[model samples]
Target chain A: MTLLERDPKSPLTWSGNLPVTSRYTFGLAGEKFFRAIKDEGKIIGSYCKKCDHTYVPASQFCEKCLAEVSDWVDVGTIGELHTFTVLYEGYDGARLVQPEIVAFISLGDGGLIHRLGEINLDEIYFGMPLEAVFLPEGQRQGSILDIRYFKPAG
Target chain B: MTMRKVAVIGAGMTKFVRRAQETPKELSWLATRMALESCELTLDDIEAVCMGTAPDSFDGIHMKGEYLSDGAGAWRKPYMRSYVGGGTGVFVPIQGWYHVASGMFDVVLVVAEEKMSNFYPHAQAAFLTIFDHTTERPLGPNLLWIFALEMNRYMTTYGISKEDIARVSVQHKRNAANHPCALLGDPDITVEDVLNSEVLAYPVQRYDVSPVSDGAVAIVLAAEHVAKRLTDKPVWVEGVGWNLDTAHWTNRDLVYPRYVEYAARMAYDMAGIKEPKKEIHIAEPYDPFDYKALHHLEGLQLAERGQAPQLYIDGTAARDGNMPVCPSGGLLGVGNPIAAAGLMKIAELFWQLRGEAGDRQVPGQPRRGIAQAWGDLMQVGTVVIMGR
Candidate 1:
């Protein structure tokens, strides 16, 4: 019998993760950005004079001007919350004991997306002043986690 | 409306290697800089950007095009990413062609990048997701196994021999010796070496397959008026076409690639060429696998059905011969970084047509060339024809 003429029967099914693992290098700008956070406990941004803009999280080029940005500056720890969301469930839909507040904090011309701490979810509001809290020295790794979380500025 | 003519003004590529120390974004930037520099144009001169990358699985990054936009010099400009498995490389220039032919953009940047090494252990694992979950994934079939089946079918159907196919690998690798960026260019390679190589699957030996690679290629495309100002030796884009068959690869005959023919026909129609074998001066058929080069040549109607092997045997496909195939060393000799490999062919044709390919340039100053790329369960074909 032809493939199209085959009789209908029980359908077949299969499920599995793609048999692949990945190891990504923190890119050129990322390596420098993370190193500064880990070694110096600093927040830095790449400044582009052509566009007169500074990009947080550091970047190799300015998106607006398409020019290489070599001038990196300390963006400082204090920032204003541009947006926030409270998550009560984990990625797999599991309930959390305490809801986590995530927010985008504006720094330089760009911003950072991280978790908010030291403030109740009800008290979290847009444009709220916040400061990054870095992990204790020696406990810091060259990662975004180097900044443990953002909290209300004193 | 009359389609505005488009021309390739400049081309650039990173070395095809087993692994790249640079990130995908950095690789994209390097190629972008080289291409823009080749044309003496900057990002400010580019009006739009077209990016082609295959399988986010290989790079281990989702939305890879968006992540690579800035490096491709897309910053604050109209940008888009196009994909069709391996066909993406060739399709990207086609995408750029329309952007100019449509008159929406006067100058466009086309970039294709692939970093297969990011997939740990073996990049073959990433290809697992490309299979149908219910019908094929359960079979656990890798690309080599399926391609072996196609290779076996082609041989049996045409009464072809292993030695005849091995010659393609030998020829391409030897040709690659002249390519500065080639990863596997072996000048003294022999057909016997291919025949004796380790067999990954029956009939598919180690030498038969293209290496997994990391690389990026970029080209600048401009409308006729802008191309005249950019460079005097602009290679005009004569035609472009692409076609995809059903994902049910099992349902189709494995002996020949019909989709490639359809796509080639579409391109020939647009280019106003009635005889591809006569009109196409240089043919860079995809050679990720040696037999694939021959397979695509037949599909592109450059050779008779099941008779492509004769081209290599008769010296007609040699770099100095009548139709120099894969003088850029092809994916077999250079490296197969998926999407970038496809765009590499476009770059090859651009250099060849402009008589600027250096040591790898073909003789007699060939005026027109055709590049074809095949991918996706062996179901899609992308073809581009360019000429001076």
Candidate 2:
């Protein structure tokens, strides 16, 4: 027999909802990474000597060499802008008074995603030099926003 | 020990829309019912059922596969859900092929559904949680950011201009005019129109992306012998392959999707296709983002590395071209309901090979077609090959 052979009648609709909520804590690796930024204005990365690679988020193991990596190295404060976008909307689906600039910053060894600051929209381009702008120590928190945003470096 | 053969006998789908009054279960039921009816079969005919859907976050339900089982026509019989983010649409059919090919089931039903409208505060916002919580989320990353970054890197690496990339949106949206299920079809769209559209992110504009949509799709698969009895013409599943890249997406170069290439190779090897560019008649690579279609085209071995963007400029990928692509309007032109969109590709291949694709049929009557879906943190790639 052929399919959908009959002009099928539409079925009745049902509307319902199941509210769900949850929370999780950052693990050890995250704890240490965040502590370093909060305690001291230092950015560290996991150095994998086996494959000669560095990860900005400080991974527990090297993805390439597959070796346990505890070697922490300083991943400088400055980076290069690989790419950027101007967003007119916020995360909550609300329009922002001013455009937001989101960028992928390429450190020498790894890449970090963050917002850009203090740069003219027209001046932004691929390969533009950038440096992390950390908030004052008194106001620092163990979060990515502690570094505030990345801005064009002289 | 030789493996049994499997064939697709029928396909069904609900109209793609931004919002549907029906619930997820109802959507699945409609599609499944149509597939069964088209194949002239009843629930008793299906030996097993497989459900394919994207993240549970969109549905705002945990254990999405389990929830969708009943409506997918998997109430009591063997049931399973195949999920790999956006690739689940095509992957579900591939998984169903296994049921018949393994001699475990004579007939299998495959269904994919996504109700993006179900999420509160807009569907786009739910994607925010896909970012890394410890390192990346602090940066307030959104879905468009990754696509923009990849698009920038690809353009810079290949020396491809935004105008060249925009051509894909222009061509695909124009082609969508013939697709009844397409959400944003426009025959008069132009390259300039894409460039001038609002920039959600640089290089990715309004037209360069697929709309967030609600849709469901289903296909009935039967063993070779059973297919012969059910339908005069059957689309055989010649080959299927899927691969995943490392989750450390930032650590590697995004210029090329190596995972997709590996996946295509696996499927091609199974299909015994050595020269894809010359052998395959049509293709439907995932196109959630416009550039991704070209990226996957290269991965599918349809064109040389860093060269797919030029195919559209030269009129090579048009529906009437020698190697037509996404004749069903693709996720870019049609609505993108994630998993449903991908399965829609396989459905397109089935209908196209049977010469049943009314207004969107490719000329010359194609014999072989390929469809692919990609998802999961720029990692997973799923491929399926079919022939009449």
Candidate 3:
């Protein structure tokens, strides 16, 4: 008996790409979160009283308590770096001109992932205090990029 | 090992809409919360969660089942998602039934959600990928175009006319006037209105097709003991059956959906239902298109082939009729949000069987009802028979 294997000589393969496009709404909480950043130049979070947790970037429900979080609070522009990673290449695997430092900045009970600026890679450390840098009000488009990056706080 | 009996204790759904401000996750959460509250239960009480959502392309989210897990109340618990194209809605509850019927979980939460509005221009664009890449895709076929062919075949084979099929839309739309969550409920919709509506594809008019929608639906299933504890009116899951035809739809005869009949037969056998037309008092067949309702009825053996439209003509499919079909408006009036629409039919059965379907309830107290969903290149059929 012969075992079946991939027949390299077979010409029975077809290749194609899915032709689909999409447009997304920011959602209930997302709209509020982005609007706060764009209009007020402030960071907001949805508070779940049951879990005593505040979700950064805002959300409608708390995963821990499975409770609806309607309480919105400004977590302020200040946060502390909880973790960090440096990307040396673009998403397409193209080598970048400069390394990009991305960090998870802890706010209240939750955090935001943003790029760290105005700091040297060798000096970056855990628990470093940071503050957000926003673009000019006229340029803000209710997007995450509205907050340019997180710089080291005094 | 003895199989444990499972029953639906509660069900809930969000309003069907063309566009929703809430994200897909939020929609699932809203439905899940309401389902739990209906039975005075909480996330802690649920032992397992089963999630169902059709093609991720609709929402532009990959691995959507995992993305929607926490929102479905699956945190720190056993959770799984099932997909059978559009059949996911009815299939998810069947998945939940097994969780309890297997004596593995006392209480299970089943959720089905779809956010089709995320697909730009129209959700139909996403369906373009569902076809065979070589054989069907190159022909540039959309869902409406292909279904038009099937509709033509069905009409030609049965010698049915478009006027008879238009009646199904009018009746279902009128019935939806009573459904608070329906998107296209119209009490005054007439046959002429449907016939006059803009034609999308030949033999398939705008009114003949269900609208693209976004929505979510959730149902709570519990074992006999827990269901009895939760509510006096428990709608038992009597039988569930699903079957798939060849993916190469071109090779098959479009005159009849033999797959639906096979699935219905499997369900009837397990349900101990000898005469589906007599034993099943109500039916919620997938009706994404007006003719589909009649097509599925014949497949479910509720009526003879080509004669299913007579049920609508004679008023037997009315809410107050002897054998009511799609009393909750079906997909025609309720809106077709893919997976969510299928689950909506199951939720309707749950409510109608419990006499909880307020203004839409059928008279004479319907004791048993069936809900079926069809999906994929018109290849799969999922059926569930529920009883009080």
Candidate 4:
């Protein structure tokens, strides 16, 4: 009802806050597995013996099972897109020239969500298959972006 | 042998917003004043105050309850703040029930507020604080990522899709068009619109999420004797319950909110609601995201497992449908001021149960209604069962 323009005196704002250093670093096993994807063009997951559920972007300990998840499983890079969305607006209201396609790619027993690359937004379907495409090892940053995103399989 | 019955004697709220220009104190004062006026009572009438707020960072104000006490009319009164993050709204009423149920106070003024607009640069950054500060926060993960993951898991387990989930946004926003305080109500949205919105995380788009908001809501609760003397159509507080799960969110299966189910069971048992699907005429479940509404619907036993999305698609959850939900447009349509958003749902349930919801009311005289709110690191769930 009362729309006021941005005033410095306004009680709410996010001016000085900034995420210092790297904002995308994964944890222990997550970092290792993500690096493997970048250097070896492979995906990996962690298995919890107690829960018997595998976790992607491998974790040292099962979050649900709360048990040791030391076993590692290399997930195939190829998977199907379970769901997706296209982004036209950046976080701070900046308009994007080309919408980015983000999707959840389901792996062997678990799934990982990421930005979809080299794909048309309209062409994406619920069950469409895709594969992870890695950046060159030299350019790998050990982040989710290391793989860029799951692209259409050949 | 039983505890004293309680009734909501007053209710008030401020205009919901994506970002408010006023300070948290000013916003809380606005709603607190409105509530006192509705109840024909002054600050002196409230013997105690129970405040509920979602998080400390949303407003960039820490120990927010104490910071907000003056605005909530707790200046020098016996007061305490309760939090279950998003669940704080429903949790407030439950807190009030205890105050009255314990005979500690005949009148407890319950207030909920969230000034999310305070986090200006990008609200997503607040997500970092919700994680295990020691273990999980070290990893850069946004709040949307968790919801997206949970939604992905829910969809996988239930065979649902983005279209099915978007249908909820479309329907609720359409319903919200009638709510005066709604912030994101749009009847013209298509699944394409939601799909094309900005991506915060995979399976989560800009449109699928509730907007960050600044707002406040309040309700004055009174014991049976006081309620009977004040109004004839008082809605009785039948039952209330809240529970929390393990903090390790990633450790649990995201497909279902078992904590919410357990919380609901506690409330239903106390309320004697054996068949929520049929016994309860109207319902309001938390809906921070479109999928959350469906998830909570299943959790509240309003529908069978995986059957919530189908109800949304079949016009079953519509205002005039078999089981109406989020009639106040939910958090999806109405502004989501976090704590205030959940209370807004409770307010909607109050209006519906009393047949005062105007266009948003369920088809007939809904004798029994339920309002539930979920919060925390996917851990807290609160429920309130009410009947007229």
**Predicted model with the maximum TM-score:** 2
Report the C-alpha lDDT of model 4 over A11-86, residue by residue, as the tens digit.
4444654344545445677666866766777788888877887776577887665687888888788988766555
Runs with alpha carbons beyond 4 Å of true place in candidate 2: A1-21, A92-94
Q: Scored by CA lDDT, what does every candidate get?
A: 0.86, 0.85, 0.85, 0.80
Residue range with the least summed lDDT across 10 consecutive positions in model 3 chain B: B132-141
> Runs in model 3 with CA error above 4 Å?
A1-154
Docking class of 4: incorrect
The sequence of per-residue lDDT tens digits that candidate 2 reaches over residues B64-178 is: 8999899899989999988898888888998998888999999999999999877765677677777787788766677877888888888887898888888888778877889
The value of fnat for model 2 is 0.49
Each prediction's RMSD to truth: 21.6, 4.9, 23.3, 5.2
- TM-score per candidate, in order? 0.72, 0.93, 0.72, 0.78
Q: Model 4 chain A: which ten-residue window has the lowest total lDDT?
A: A1-10
For B58-84, candidate 4 gives per-residue lDDT tens digits of 777778899999999998899889988
After superposing all C-alphas onto the true structure, candidate 1 shows an RMSD in angstroms of 21.6
For A35-109, candidate 1 gives per-residue lDDT tens digits of 898999988999999888787868888766678899999999999876544543332223457756666577887
